[model samples]
Target: MPWGERPRWARWVSVIWIVGFVEGTGAHLLDLISGGLHAYHAWPLPSQVLFHALLVVDLLVAVLVARGLPSGPPLGAAVMVTDLTANYQGNWSGLLHEPLAYVGVTGLLPMTLFGLFVVGTALPLGRAFRGIVRPV
Candidate 1:
């Protein structure tokens, strides 16, 4: 089948999936190149470690979502929710940094928008599957 022949929800989900993957991967790379998570400022070592660990998970979710496999939507939705929550935390913590503060500030809106899109597409896919199994 041609790529666009899939359900509309699936198409939108795939779009958001790619967006998230690119954004997450970009953030991690920026963090690395800037000299580790807290290298710009100073956070406790444990918190910094946990922060980077979460970013890794974020990147993995992006990969899963971008794969666009038929079975991945619901799981990707869950991951997107978690990822948004983490982004929220990052936004709040970002208050501590002056020069880099825009990272958190600018991300808030896109993250919220994509988070909604992920959740929106995930639920319908689940319901559609349920209908398929029931065979009305």
Candidate 2:
């Protein structure tokens, strides 16, 4: 209720982002744990760094959004943008040239969908969080 009226959509957006980040955390954790810290060694060093950073940013955004912090929307948007870039960079060949071939490729579809969701909801979320106060 701290979000006042017109918060229904905000709540839905927050939950969607939380769920996405939680899943991202789990996935990145498994990837690192299974392949060690250098799991993405095949990628360029910067790309590898980006992949590693995903774990932290994903978790951070989730916490920020859950707590009704004002930074959630923008930060979430940035995370998704960066994540989508990384994914696209690695998969652009198949994605651009053979789009249908990537219909069910691992985490690609979900990440893209969630990224689009974050982008579409960013403006509304920004307006909503402009005056949000953490509920006691």
lDDT of 2 by residue, 48-114 (tens): 8988888888899888888877788889899889888988898787788988877774668878888
Worst 10 residues of 1 by lDDT: 127-136
Tell me how many clashing residue pairs each candidate has.
0, 0
Q: Which one is best on lDDT?
A: 2
lDDT of 2: 0.81
Query: Which lDDT tens digits does candidate 1 get at residues 1-136?
Result: 1235555655565666767756766776788778864653454455466457656666665555555444456766776676666556655655456535454545666667777877876766444433332222
- C-alpha lDDT score of every prediction, in listed order: 0.60, 0.81
- Model 1: colliding residue pairs: none
CA RMSD of all predictions: 5.3, 4.2
TM per candidate: 0.59, 0.86
Off by over 4 Å in 1: 1-5, 37-50, 89-105, 125-136
